[model samples]
Target: MSNQTSVTEFLLLGVTDIQELNPILFVIFFTIYFVNITGNGAILMIVILASRLSFCGPNHVHHFFCDIKPLLDLACGNTELNLWLLNTVTGTIALTPFFLTFLSYFYIITYLFLKTHSCTMLHKALSTCASHFMVVILLYVPVLFTYIRPASGSSLDQDRIIAIMYSVVTPALNPLIYTLRNKEVRNALNRKVRRWL
Candidate 1:
């Protein structure tokens, strides 16, 4: 008889290899994972209640947080259904917001060019969308690179790098982008600074 056993669980390659660092890593990653869930869950809830978004699941994740690609990577049984959902359901979740954002900018540009015909207004509108657009690009480009292909082509190391790019780097830069580009945020910050002085 063949002693073939299927994989039932996965151990993620965490941030460190040192046994002593395990506890610290756990705490840090747990906090990050918790916040990631809380934040994304809030958005999911909003989408669910406001619109009609749904998700079904299996219970393994290769990445630190419950990102879709990582979770799919750990699917214990055949991943046909999971892959389908990734294409249809997850694709909708990921791409719809991007498409809508794109359309909004498209309309804004169209209105500015055809209706308004003001270079100053056009520049202002583009500038207003710039930060948001940059954030979207930062997030979605990596995601598309990671998920928009057949899973067989994905390298775990590559996925990890890109995952960090979208998950950590994009979120970290978002506020900076907003603050730098947004006069309103700058003014509010200046007001607070003056008061503190």
Candidate 2:
């Protein structure tokens, strides 16, 4: 809950200002989205930049989602505690998973190195993990930049752009990333395309 609040729904300004590109962007995103979902049942998701809004609003959110970071920009009163909470929660959430994921990769890679003598087999194993690692880095780097910092360090426009990377771009690219890396999936997809042709 916020103090000294104005009661109005926010006007959401989306990722870009150019009116002409919306349809083009929409179509591109839609195709990626369709492939992301259809190619597999599900691919990915994350939550960061979660913060309380303590705003006396003019009712404009300069982001597509009315995201907390943007709303925090509009917030009024003492927001230090809100910022602290945001940093703590976001840091804990972000780092824990990232730590676990990295640790898992380390052990897995170590096991592969120690247990396998075949250099070719090791290359194949590492290549398979590359797409997943790319997805992880794609997700975490933006998340870390966005939320794991003092509130003053965050820029709303940058936050919006980073949001696009993780939420829209990452998920959209996931099917391509995973499919291209996987020989079986790639062959199956190629076969399907050949049939259509």
Candidate 3:
């Protein structure tokens, strides 16, 4: 009988190699994970309620996708609990990653400054951070804006626009921003520019 294990390989850059930073990293990751799971678990209740409740009104979803708010709008009964659940989950999913990412950046900047004391290195680091943070801000801000407002105040048109921002714009920008930082990408762009010239 073979001792069967399906998992083949995995790679992990242990957050940080520094022993001193382990505790801080652990807490940050754990907090984000815990809060994220808890928020998602709350949605299960919403799902259960969706099945139990009688849906009223036109089946037409106002938004592009069947988002929680739009779905709840279709429900016959009062959706106070469902709305609250959606808001809470959205807030957690949106904010937790944003704040934690910033925290990581802060620590990285501090560490780099203290260790190297190189202005060029700091500038390079900040540029990378700025690009990443830009993406994070673009993605999270619109999502938070759409979800945090009072349900009554939610404009479907506005949401579709915001959805385009976070869903379409952010993702489209990610590869462009990150790839621009690569040496190979720079060379490729330079070649293209030279050919055009």
> What's the TM-score of each model vs. the native?
0.56, 0.65, 0.72
lDDT of 2 by residue, 150-188 (tens): 776778778889999989998888778987876798899
Candidate 3 on 1-197: residue-level lDDT in tens?
A: 99798666432335567889868877887897987687667878778877677776788888877777777778899788878877777777778777898899889878887897778888988888888888777777898898888988887788889988877888999889889989899999999999999
Q: Give every collision pair in model 2.
A: none
Name the 10 consecutive residues with the lowest summed lDDT in model 1. Answer: 46-55
Q: Give the TM-score comparing model 1 with the true structure, all chains together.
A: 0.56
Q: CA lDDT of 43 in candidate 2?
A: 14
Q: What is the C-alpha lDDT of each candidate?
A: 0.71, 0.75, 0.81
Q: In TM-score terms, which candidate is top?
A: 3
Clashing pairs in 3: none
Roughly what TM-score does model 2 have, to 2 decimal places?
0.65
Q: Candidate 1's residue-wise lDDT over 67-134, tens digit each?
A: 65565455444555556545554555677778988998888877778887777887888788777789
